[model samples]
Target: MDCLNCFEITARLHMYIDRELNSEEIAIVQEHLEDCPSCECRFHFDMRIKRLVHERCTIQHAPQHLREAVMRLAHAPAGTYAELDPELVKEIKADLKGGG
Candidate 1:
């Protein structure tokens, strides 16, 4: 099988991490990830984010501000959220603690 490039692997990252891809696709993605460190790092980061959300976000309806903050984080590039604003990260952490 031809190795998948970064674009293909990243494009399917969410599905791959969620186990939504079929066996062959999973094999292809796994092969690409094993060969490419950059994609692997991104995959791990996304997995952490997904796990964090699953662990913390149990409420049926999040507040508007919380939702907005999450959207901001979601749109941000990997590892850029804290660099963009450490204060915002702190605030979010505090809010999550209080809300929990």
Candidate 2:
């Protein structure tokens, strides 16, 4: 399953690395990885990066106020949560392109 050079596939690489991919997409990524060195390296790199980050970072509870704010927003209209944290999203997009 050779994937096109598209954003959807890029978005999915992170999901796949996180084990958040659904079954069908998982199968596609699994097949693609077997044949695609670039994608395979991307997967390995992302996995290693995340693993190292987790290993080094101490787990800390989210502040009570932050949790409460999220909880309050959870019940809001669907579009309310649509906005992404630009900085984090940029980091994700950059990492997907093999640029840390």
lDDT for each candidate structure? 0.85, 0.71
Pairs in clash, predicted candidate 1: none
- lDDT tens per residue, model 1, 1-100: 5777899899999999889999999999998899899999999999999999998997678765667777877888887733435666677778789988
Per-residue lDDT over 24-89 for candidate 2, one digit per residue giving the tens place of the 0 to 100 score: 888887877787788788878888999899888968665455455566668678775555456655
Among all candidates shown, the one with the greatest TM-score: 1
The clash count of every prediction, one per candidate, is 0, 0
lDDT of 2 at 33: 78
